[model samples]
Target: MGADYLKEMFGLEGQTAVVVGGAGVLGGALCRGLVQAGAKVIVADLMEEPCRKQVDELTQLGGQAAYVVVDVTSRESIESLLADSLKQSERIEILVNCAGVNAGNDFLDATDQDWDRIMAINLRAVFQACQVFGRHMIQAGGGKIVNIGSVTSHLPLSRVWAYSASKAAVLNLTRNVAQEFAEKGIRVNAICPGFFPAEQNRKVLTQERIDNIMHGTPMKRFGEPEELIGALLLLVSPIAGQFITGTHINVDGGFTAAWF
Candidate 1:
């Protein structure tokens, strides 16, 4: 009975999750977690190769997963992703917006191109995906959305002005969308992650920057990709998280809590 209760609270059995940017480090971890919970996962990304690679990794780990190539910058591409997801699983119960990009440059050196690109992928893409998937979820009754924000979403850091701004907007957008869909049974939330080393921010982690991050984070260590799985599951679970929406979880190891 206890096992059944736990499963009833968190089991994603027979559900379908579409994770945009599921080819990347953090996204891949979420996909694996969804699979472990008995959900069929669709790994969506810009590149066919990386998407396929992520799917293979998930399958090898005994998870059911598939790949769908997408260009988040394009509305049509995101629409295609939604259609393809429906084709694969007949329905999408969970959606995770995790695709993002970043670059480090002196405030005076930042260019319009850099800002535009980051905003397009980090903020604009998320907006579009939510709208497209949200309409479907609303009509189908309900769904869950987890948008990837960052520690910068709460507080700004040096050297990544555009990224910080975009992430801050993401949290705001998450709240607005969540409020709009609350009565519609669609729960929208954001996950603000701390400094984790990933391909997108690898170049931005200069030695000096790394030192500052360690000092700011109470944990004094980077978060492992898998460490975010629990929070993701909590936000995605239909019963356990039924009443949760419009808020965000900061998985930054007390980074936001530290003043020094």
Candidate 2:
């Protein structure tokens, strides 16, 4: 809001950050935003093409960035990501866990494999990333962690039972990590976003789904990927968020506040 607020409170210059799932739309937006604020970013994704694309975009825009292929479902992949990250900057002072997915199956149609996959990617991935990179943060003396949740986790959404359940778990995971690591100087929190078209929801968000979302959202529009930058910066910047932890800031443009 003011120069002092930014100059004194929201500085992230020169910090090294790791953003899991940085290949997707929202994740790409976050990587660029962090770069603008002067944080060195590692764009970690499951695939190389999209991840490299993000790195190219950031480098073109004069930002410090790199790519790491990570399988959120595997412990070995997480370890490699952290290892490669250290090779680049030797520290992951800030991490944003965005490696999540939704199979979009109804509870009745959901199978065991579907359940396991969602849990591993959406919930356990965050747990693994935090535990691995979090150890680095702890050794270095402090850090920031932002886990991504979704509005559907709490909203009465249909045909995505496992996704909702996993996201809900993230809410508690954020708090628990915070409480356990606060004294050690790691701040963990989650961001529960409202409906926005992404890789997972594209198929379901047809014309009919658009009508439903716009009608339901108080803002009456889908959120742009850029809309999340400010809140992200606030949470990741220890200067601003040193006293904030075990909490979530909803950036849904009033999607949760309205029941009408």
Candidate 3:
């Protein structure tokens, strides 16, 4: 009875979820979580090869899964992703914006191109996807959206100026959109992850930086990609997260809670 009750509250048996950046490490974990919860998963990303691979893996796990190539930097491409995903599922019940990029440099050494590129993928792309998918969810009656944020969203780290700035903006945008969609039965929230070893930040996580992270993080360990699944499920689950919106979960090993 307890198991049944938990499933009733958190199971996504018939829902459809589109996970943008589903090919990446953390994103892949989020995709797996959604699928395991019983939602049909659409793996959306920039490269068809990676997206296909992710879908294949999800299918192997006994999940209904497919892929749609999306260059989040382009609005038209985002719209196309929606059209393609709708072809497979009647309506999308959840959207997870997980696509992101990063670079580290001294303030004087940052380039305009880098800043623009990071913002395009990390911040602007999220805004576009929310608007596009939010419209669909509104018409479909209701849905959930989870924007992937970073510990930087709350406490900016040194040397990753654009990434920090863009993440901060994403959290702000999540709240604003949440308010706008609250009356529409759509809940928008964010998950701020601490340091996880992902491709986007590989270049930035030098040994010294790793030490600094461990020092500030109370847990003294980097988070695993899979560790984020619980928070993701909570934010997107209709029953468990029904009353949760316009807020964020900091899954950062208490990094955000530390004082020193």
Say which candidate scores most in TM-score: 3
Over 1-260, each residue of candidate 2 has an lDDT whose tens digit, in order, gives 88767866876777999999999888999898899888899999999999999999999989999999999899999999999999999678999998888776667877899899989999998999889988999999999999998886566577777888898889988899999999999999888888766877886677887897788788898898888888899899858778999999888878778853
**TM per prediction:** 0.98, 0.96, 0.98
lDDT (Cα atoms) of all candidates against the true structure: 0.94, 0.87, 0.94
Candidate 1 residues 122-183, lDDT tens each?
99999999999999999899999999999989887888889999999999999999999999
Off by over 4 Å in 1: none
lDDT of 3 by residue, 150-215 (tens): 989987789997899999999999999999999999999999999898886789888899989899
TM-score of candidate 3 versus the correct structure, residues matched by position: 0.98
Q: What is the C-alpha RMSD of each candidate to the true structure, in Å?
A: 1.1, 1.5, 0.9
Please list all clashing residue pairs in model 2, or write none if there are none. none
Most lDDT-accurate candidate = 3
Q: CA lDDT of 180 in candidate 3?
A: 96
